[model samples]
Target: MGSDRTPIFLCAALLLLLVVGLFIPNWLVFLFTISMAKGLVVLGLILLMRTGLVSFGQGLYYCLGGYIVGISGQHWGITDVALVFLLVVLAATLLSSILGLLLCRYREIFFAMLTMAFSMILYGILVKSEKLGSTDGFIIAQATLFGWQPEVEASGTWIFALAVIITLVALLVMHLYFRSPMGFGGEAIRENEIRVEYLGVSPRRLIYIKYVVAAVLAAFGGAITAVAAGHVDPEMAFWATSGEFVFIALLGGTLHVAAPLVGAFLIEIIRTIALDLAPYTWQMILGGSLLLIIFFLPKGLWSLLPKRREEEGL
Candidate 1:
């Protein structure tokens, strides 16, 4: 029990820092919140990664989520943040249910390719449509907090709050999931599906459930992002955006729950610097770093450190 308390303490400390950040004046807090929101998306990817599956179509749900929020809040005049959140989750659930039927069947590169195709199709539609605001994408009117202002100066702060709350909730849920019997089943499916089948568990059903869970989480990330940015673009569904999520997952080393958040922040910081430092070569540098990480770490940046593995079991 003492050993298990470590990740809990780390998580608590992280939340504490996020709370403290709300009181600070730095614009970086906004970036931190953005990273956390994106982290939620990667957190969903973490589940699929753990299941030994890689999805490139997560942007499909993520983009859909942003569109849902944008269309609802802007076109339908839905201004309540809570209501938007609910709608995003419901939309993601339905989308994933439909996508899961087709996705849960394919494995390996085929699955990844199929997801990429679906994502591109969504991007194309968003780019070509004018009523959906085309590439221009509409700005969100102020979101009301139960019919009250949440303080204009603290708009970023409230976003950060939402990010932290969503992340903590997702982590708690995943923690329980990892400790459940189904978790063991998931690992079994990841390691050897045929063996799990002999044990009488339905791998397909389990994966489908995981698929929906991942989609909902990704959608939550996207909806929050749209609200925070006050805009939505077709670029949100681009292949590069999907690749960025994968990069974050790989950077953090994906061995533990905290890995994705760490990766998300690190990538954001690195990209921020790279964009400021060398606009033209930023992609080159990013690509180079990714290759190096892949070649040297293979398992990811977490594997390079000795602290977590020996003590945390990740």
Candidate 2:
């Protein structure tokens, strides 16, 4: 029954958030929009983690998505936000498809390092490209939604609504994916790759599929973030940005689909406070907070919730 109602509950919560956005300050709405975008990236990380893999370079796709949106707008004169999003997804799919073929062959540290290397390579290329603004990056033009232009003051509300809707759809899709055969196969691979192979399921193939899906999600997040921020920078591809995704994934735990979104918002709020309180030592405070969570709630913040009685055969 709990499982059956999860979707309904998620939908209700998202709807409530959308309504609440209308009443919040524009700055808060913008913050929520960015957090939701980052949450999508963390969701992808969670998917990979379930398969016993961690990516240190998902920012590769994230930056790719943002840059493609910016370039499409500034260079190609494409202003439709929806079209830019579709293009970003296609670009991410094409790149990840080719990259996955090679990346799926490795596991553990090798996979992590290789992913980071590819992202850094992109970073270096961007830094050297003067036309792309080099290290400073470039500004993204204001985006139009389905031929409707929003005033600057009202854009945040529209973007927040879009983010909420997309996030809800993503959550539903991911939740379904988590229960499908392919998803179960990921858990199986994580537990015992040899056994999975003995059952005639190739773990490499599963990893490849998961990697591509993750890249797509990351790209979606980046595109939304680019739209929300009104700018794109090479820092989007930095290892530190990817690290934050991983941090949120771990902070939220892999047990629930909504956990990453919760973690992202909480972390963002905490970071804001930390920055305000201790600008030079914010990272230290954040690290300390993580350590406390790890020591007290090994499964993550989600573990604090009461376990479903059905899981205990109640």
Candidate 3:
């Protein structure tokens, strides 16, 4: 019965988001779009966390996605939005597949550091390549859908709608993934890798697959964010950016697939408010809030939702 209601709840939430996009101010809609993009990256991080892993370098894929979009439009003259997205996914997947072969062998801090190292390497390369605009990055051309360019006023709305659709589809797919046998292996590996191996599952192989999936998700996020912002930069791959995704993942928790989306929204809203209220001390404010959440709601904001009646024995 509970399983039956899950789809209904997700559909309703998606509808609500669509309604919100229609009525919200343009600035707010743009902010929401950015949050949704970041949410995708956080979603990938949550996947890794479920398997007792954390990536400090998801920014690598995120940056690659944005750069591919920007570079393709500027240099390659690739104006088709659909094709750009496809290329980004393909590039991210190929790169991640190669890296995962090496990364999947390690665990814990080694994994985290190796991920960060790869991301930083990209950052350094971008910073040195003046042709790619160095550290300043470059603007992305306006995108078209089905050969139709949006009027200036409607562009934000169009991008917002696209972001929403992408997020909903990704969420539904990830929800299914979480219930699959491989997803079950994530938990088992997290709990006991040796036991999982004894049970005829290859923990390393599972981790590699999860890593690739996470990279692809982060790439999609970067692609969408570049389109919404009309800009791409090396900063997108910076360690601080990756840290923000990790923070969002922790803030949202891994209990539910939707947690990352909610958490990303909350964080973006809080950051906006904090910057307005205390521009100089906004970082301090954000840090304080995280400390509070960690102390009081260690399971993350998602856990605050009321349990179902069945769960409560009612």
lDDT of 2 by residue, 97-203 (tens): 99999999999999999999999999999999999999999999889988888998787889889899989999999988987789888888889999999999999
Q: Tell me the tens digit of each residue's lDDT in model 1 across 1-314.
A: 23455447657867796778867775788778778878889988878888888888889888988888888877898888888889999999997899899999988798889988998999999989998888887787777778876777778787778778888888778766765678667777889999998999889998899889999998988888887888899998999889888888888876766778888888888878898899999988777877888888888877765664434642
Estimate the TM-score for candidate 2: 0.96
Model 2 CA lDDT for position 211? 98
lDDT of 2: 0.90
lDDT of 2 at 81: 85
By summed lDDT, which 10 consecutive residues of candidate 2 come out lowest? 305-314
- The lDDT values for all models are 0.82, 0.90, 0.91
Task: For model 3, give the 10-residue run with minimal summed lDDT.
Answer: 305-314
Judged by lDDT against the true structure, how good is candidate 1?
Answer: 0.82
lDDT (0-100) at residue 200 of candidate 3?
92
TM-score: model 1 vs. ground truth: 0.93
What TM-score goes with each of the models? 0.93, 0.96, 0.96
